[model samples]
Target: MLNAMSFAHTVGNIRHHFPGLPTLLAKATPERSGDILAGIAAKSAEERVAAQCALADLPLQHFLNDQVVPYETDEVTRLIIDTHNAKAFAPVQSLTVGELRNWLLSDEATPERLAALAPGLTPEMAAAVSKLMRLQDLIVAAAKIRVVTRFRTTVGLPGRLSARLQPNHPTDDPAGIAASILDGLLLGSGDAVIGINPAGDSPAVTAHLLRLIDALRQRFSIPIQSCVLAHITTQMAALESGAPVDLIFQSIAGTEAANRSFGINLALLKEANDAGQKLNRGTVGDNVMYFETGQGSALSANAHYGAGGLGVDQQTLEARAYAVARAFSPMLVNTVVGFIGPEYLYNGKQITRAGLEDHFCGKLLGLPMGCDVCYTNHAEADQDDTDALLTLLGAAGVNYIMGVPGADDVMLNYQSTSFHDALYVRRILGLKPAPEFEAWLAGDEYARLMLEATHPERLLTA
Candidate 1:
C-alpha cells in the first residue's frame, strides 16, 4: 500500500499535525474570508505558520503524487497531471517547495530559466511557494517571468501595460456603449480589448453589440480587438449567425462541479476555442481565448471538496483555475479579484493580497495574466484600495487592467480602474500600451482627435 502523506510542525510548546496534503494546503494559505466561510482556514496564526513550515519542507514531487482533487473525479486534475512536462521538470525535480521559493527568488532564476520551468510547475506548487513569499518577493519573482500573448494586440510584454475598455450599458444601448468607447480611446485605453458585459444574454443582443464594436473599430481603423462578455454558448451562437467574433470569453473555475455550475465543461471550452480560431480574426497572432476566474467560485458553487472529501482552501482552488487557463493558450486570463464581493475577500487588504497572489501564480505558470482591479459597493473597500492595487500590479508587470469609465461600471454595478487610471500607471512606471495600439495613438489623426475631443454625452445624440 502507498504510504499516507502527513505533515507536522512544532510551534513553541505546541505541535500541530495535519492529516494530508489538502489539509496542509488549506491551513497554510494566507487568511481569507472565503476559506473561513468554507470552514478550512487556519485556526490560529501559529497553526498557519506551522503549516507553512511543513509545506516548505515537503518535496515538490509530492504535488504530482497527491492530487488535491482526485484525478478520476476531476478533469482539471487529470489535465494538470497528464500534461506535466517531465523533461522541463528535470531542473528542479528534487527541490522541496521551500527550496523552490528560494530558487525562484535567486539570481540564477533568470527570465529564460523561469520561462523554461513554467510548463513543469503545477498550480499547487505555485500556490505553495507563494504562501512562503513576502509581497515584494511576489512582485520581484513575477517580474522575471513573462508570459506574452497576441491577438490584434500584443500583451504581457515586459515594458508594456494594456487596458480593457469596458463600455457596458445598463440597457445594452449601442449609443451609450459608443460614448464610453470614445471616452476610453481618448484616454489612451482599450489596447487589451474593448469587452462588454451585456445586460442580457440573448444571442441577438450579443451579435448586435459585436457588430457595433466592430463597426467602430473599422470606422476608426483602431488596431484592437472586441468582445461581448456573454455566455460562451451565446458567443458561439452569435458566431454561427455570422457575427464578428474576435475572442471567445468565459468564466472558468478550478473544479469540474464548479465549472458545471457555470454550464461549461472542458469539451465545450475546446469547441469554443476551435470556433474562435477558425474565424481567423486576429491580425497579430492567434491566441484567441479570454478567461476570468475568482477565488470563491468553487465554494460558492458548493463544489470545493478535495481529496477524501475535505474542504480545499479558496486560494489553492484559485490557483487551480490557472491550470484550466494555461491549457487553452489564452490571449488573456484575469482574476476578477474583488468583483465577487466582501463575503469572499472581506476587505481591501485581503483583496490586495489575493490580486498579487493570483498574478504571481498565473505568470509563474506561463499565462498572460491580468487583473480586474476592482470591488463592489458593499465591500469594505474604496477607490483608494483599487488605486494602491493598480499601482502595485503595474510595478509587478501585470499585463492589463480594466478601464471602466470613471472607475464605475453602471451596468455591472461595481468599481474598476478607470481609463485615466491606465494613463496614470503608464506615466509613472514608464510603461506604454501594446505596440500596435501605441503606433495608432501616436498618429497625427489621433493627436488631432484628442485636441478636438468632444463631450462624450453628445455622442448619444450625434
Candidate 2:
C-alpha cells in the first residue's frame, strides 16, 4: 500500500529526511556581498553580463555595487579578445590512431616522468584527459567510422563496453588508461566522457584530473560536463587526508544526512539553495551544473548507499523520484533520476517493453530521467532491452541516457550495437553526425604538436 500526496508534502517529507542541509536565508551581510561580487568579477565578460542580469531585478544592487568595480585598464578584456582570436585563426593538422597510441605507450612514459607530471595535475583535469584518451582508443580500434561517444569508464576496462572483451590487465594505471583513451580520440573517432571516482581524496587523484583538464584545454578547448561524484561521503574522507578540496566535497555525510533527517528539511533546502547562489555568481548559469539526490529503489542498485532503501515498486520509485525532484528544484536545473528498479537484474526479464515505456520512462521524464542500462552483459539482450528502453525514453521525453558499451546482457559488435545506438540516439535527438574521424585526427595531431612545442610545461609543471 502506498500513500499519494501533493508536491508540497513530498518536498516536506524530503526536508524531514535531510535536516542538516544548508539554507540560503541568512541575510546577505556586507562582507558576504563583497565576496559574491568579487567572485562575479573574476568571471569572463560574458559571464559578468549574465550574472548582472540575474541580479538586475533583485535587491542586490548594494551587493553588486560594493563588490564589482568597473574595469578601466581593459587588460582582462584584451586578454580575452586575444585568446579568442588565436583560436579562431589557428590552423589544423591531422593525427592518426596508430601515431597517438605509439606516443602514449612509448618508452618516454617512465614512472619518473609520470611522477614529474603528477604534481601539476588536478583530479578533475585527470578525469577529463582519461575520457579523451579512452575515446581515442575506441576510434583507433574501430578504424572505420567517425563517431563521438560520451560515457564514463570504470578503472580497468578499455572501450566503453562494460563487458570487457579482453582480460583485465594488472598494469592498468588510471593515468595510463586516460592517456590511451585520449590517444584514441585524438587519432579521431569522437569525444568521450570519463567518470572520475577519486580513490581516497589523495593529491594523486586531484593531480590526475588537473592534467586531464590541461590536455583537453590545450587540444580541444572543450568544457567538461557530466561530472559523476559518486559516494560523496567516502570522497570527502579522502580529501581530508591531503586530497584537493576543489574536487571533493567537505561534508558528504552531513549533506546526505541533512537531506534525510526529518526535522531539518528547511535548513537543508536553505543550504542547497545558498550553494546554488554561490555557484551562480561565478559562471554563466550554464557551467555550474548540479545533480539531484534521491532515495534508491534497492540495495543491489549500482549507486552509493545514501541512495538506497526506497523500495522496488514502480509507484514507490516514481514517488521517491518526484519527491527528490521537488526538494532539489530550487538548487538544480539538471538532474538524473534512476527510473529502473533496484532488482533490475532479476525483475528486468519480467518487465515488458510497454511497462518500461509507460511506467518507468514516461513517469520519470517529468524530471530529467537518467536511464541506467544496468544489465548490459549480453549485447543482443542489452540492445533489445535498450531499443525498447530508448523508444520508451524518447516517448517519455528523456534527454539523456547513461550506459556502457557491451557492459550489459547485449552484445553490440562494434558495428551494430554501439554504432547503431549512437546513430539512433542522434536521429531521435535530431543531431547531426559528428565530424569525420580523419578531420578530427588531423586537428588533434596539430593540437598535440602545438602543445608539445609551445607549452610542454603545461603538461609537465603543476
Best by TM-score: 1
Q: For all candidates, what are the clash counts?
A: 0, 69
Off by over 4 Å in 2: 1-172, 176-194, 198-207, 226-228, 233-314, 329-366, 376-381, 403-420, 427-429, 432-462
Q: What Cα-based lDDT does every candidate model obtain?
A: 0.92, 0.28
- Candidates in order, TM-scores: namely 0.97, 0.40
193-268, model 2: which lDDT tens digit per residue? 2234333344445444545544553455432222223333443333345332222211111122233332223344
C-alpha lDDT of residue 342 in model 2 = 28
